[model samples]
Structures are given as C-alpha cells and as structure tokens.
Target: MGPTRVRDLSVAAVAVAALGYAVVTLMYRHFPPITALSGMSLAVVALAEAGWGFYVRAQIKDGHIGIGGGRLHPLVVARSVVVAKASAWVGAGVLGWWVGVLIYLLPRRSTLRVAAEDTPGAVVAACCALALVVAALWLQHCCKSPEEPPDDAEPAAE
Candidate 1:
C-alpha cells in the first residue's frame, strides 16, 4: 500500500512538473532567443525525459492500477512510448538540422546575440541545437538493445 501510494505521488509530481514546464516554455515564447548551453540543455532534458518517460510508461504498462482505475499492460505501453520517443527524435532532428543551417548562415556573432536580437530566430536556432544534441544522444544510446545474454554463456534449457 505504501509503495503504491508513493508511486502515485511520484507520478502526480511528474505530471505537474511537465505541465509547469510547458507553461514556462509558453510564457517564454515571446522572449529573447536561447543560448547554446540552454539549447543543448533542452535537448538533453528532452532526451532524458523521453528515456525516463519510456521507462515510466513501461512501468505503467507492466500493470498495477492506473490513477484512473484500470488495468494496464507494460508491453503495450512501452511500445507506444517507444513510438512516441522515435517521433520526438525525428522531429527534433529535422528541426535541429534546419536551425543549424540557419546558424551557419548567420553572421559571425554568437547565437545568444541573435536570439536576444530576434526572438523567433533565436528560438528556432536554440531548438536546432537541441535537436543536434538529441541526435547525438540517440546515436550514442538509442540503438542499444536492453536485453542480452549473460557473460557466463549458460545455454537456456530447451
């Protein structure tokens, strides 16, 4: 019972956090552009979230009780989560690629300068940097298979 309660609380917290994050992002929509570090950070955060989201989603799939009162299966949930992650990566990648192109085409000044001077452009550029970060992360980690035989090399029973 305690464990379940804790899980519920944690899930609730994540939900609220996600909402707050969205709101903050929206509020900042009119602001100056993001810095290189910040852009990279956003991508890092998204990648981390997507990965952890898949895990939480997988847990939710593995079955317990939904906050809404329903039975669930981890496999199905994980598959859906995996698809979402893939989609996010794709979008981030394309967007980032374009942003990078723009940045490259821009003048000798820093991205931060451009972002502060032109919010929309900066935002797009920041997003591009993030996409690149995500792509790097994906290249490094996304293709890995979670399952593998143990090093002992014991054959499974027939």
Candidate 2:
C-alpha cells in the first residue's frame, strides 16, 4: 500500500472534528472533566510512538542496529509501514476530537468552572495527538526505498 497522504488525514480530521464538536455541543452538560491522568496517558503514547519512529528510521537506513543479526528484513519494514499508516489515521481522529473539545470549552470557560479547569488537559491531549501524527508520518517516510524516485517524478518508458 502507498504511504499515508496528508490530504487524506486532513479530511478525516475535519470530518471527525465536526462530528465531535456537534456531539459535545449537544451533550456538554453530561461531559466529564479532562483529568491530568488522561493527559498523561496521551503523553505516554506520544513518547512511545516517537521512540519507535526513531528506532524504525535507524533500522531502515542503517540495517545494523537491531537485535540478533542487526539487519532489518523486508517484511518487517512493510509491516512497520502499515503500522505507521494506521497510527496516523488514529492520531488524526484523536487530535480532531480533542480540538473539538477545546473549541467548545474555551468560550464557555468564563461561565463554567469545569471547562476552565479542563482546558489545559484538552490542550495537552491535542498536542500529544499531533506528536503521534508526526511520529507516524516520519516512520512511514523511513520505510520508503531509498532508490525510489520522488512521487512527482514521471516513470521511465519500458
């Protein structure tokens, strides 16, 4: 499969963000507060993904940093690409969701104490989601074959 495109991710994020904003707007009274624990969890995921991306990049370029034989197999690189694509999609959705939450809460913060308190957590969550997307995209790029031409390049005639 091809690498994850930014255009696709942007569309998905916009769609998800609109949906999330609508849902939260309609049911904000029942919404729970954004806790520090939840923010920490998102940060943990971001950190892990970033570390994995670095490791994958090293493996793909160097092929001498992994376990055992210190060489990355082709299948492993393919699988990593798949994981990166999936992670990008997931991260975009999550980022959209948190952004929706922030949009709804930011204006109401003056009147709603909970909203004011939760704003920081929502911001943290959104940033972490963005980090995940970056890490995933980097991993996908690392998986690309060095000899392959750029996407804009025309193919040679047979």
> Taking the tens digit of each residue's C-alpha lDDT, what string does model 2 give over 1-158?
77799999988888888999999999988977787565566567667767776776777667453446757767777887888899899999998898888899999999989899989988988888888888888878877765744677678879
Q: After superposing candidate 1 on the true structure, give the runs of residues whose Cα lies further than 4 Å from its correct spot.
A: 1-72, 97-101, 108-116, 119-125, 128-158
lDDT of 1 by residue, 3-43 (tens): 11224333543454455445534554453444444344546
List ranges where model 2 is wrong by over 4 Å: 63-68, 148-158
lDDT of 1 at 30: 57
lDDT of 1 at 147: 61
**Which ten-residue region of model 1 has the weakest summed lDDT?**
1-10
